[model samples]
Target: MKDINLTKEEKADAIEAIKSYFFNEKDEEITDLSASLLLDFILKQIGPLIYNQALKDTHYFMTGQLEDLFSLEKHVQRK
Candidate 1:
């Protein structure tokens, strides 16, 4: 799989969120570099699993819609 790339804004936002989580939940303050490293690790290790699961969910939903469409088809009578 290709590497997951985030926009600069998104990366910055994520890093901030990470910092906030650590501060709020763990009562620890982390540097921007530390949060960035954690974000990179999550993207590298967990991103693909989440992406694949989303694809599977979309496929399943589309298959169900297609079956419903096929069921709506009308048969024509021949002489």
Candidate 2:
């Protein structure tokens, strides 16, 4: 699988979030480098699961829209 890539800003944001989580939840101070490494690890290990869930949500949404459209078309044609 291709590596999960984030924009520079996104990476920075993620790294900061990781740092905050460590500080607040874990009660440990994490450096930017540590947060970055952790971010990469999480992305590599967990990103696919999140991506798949998003795709499933999108597919279900589109299917529902299509079904509604077809139902509306049939209803209009019967008039």
Best-matching candidate per lDDT:
1
| Candidate 1 structure quality by residue, lDDT tens digits, 1-79 | 8899999999999999999999999999999999999999999999999999999999999999999998889998999
Model 2: number of backbone collisions: 0
Highest TM-score: give the candidate number.
1
lDDT of 2 by residue, 1-79 (tens): 5788899999999999999999999999989999998898899889998988999999999999998887666434553
Residue ranges of candidate 2 with Cα displaced over 4 Å = 74-79
Candidate 2, run of 10 with poorest lDDT: 70-79
Note the residue pairs that clash in candidate 2: none
Q: What TM-score should be assigned to candidate 1?
A: 0.92
Task: Sum up the clashes in candidate 1.
Answer: 0
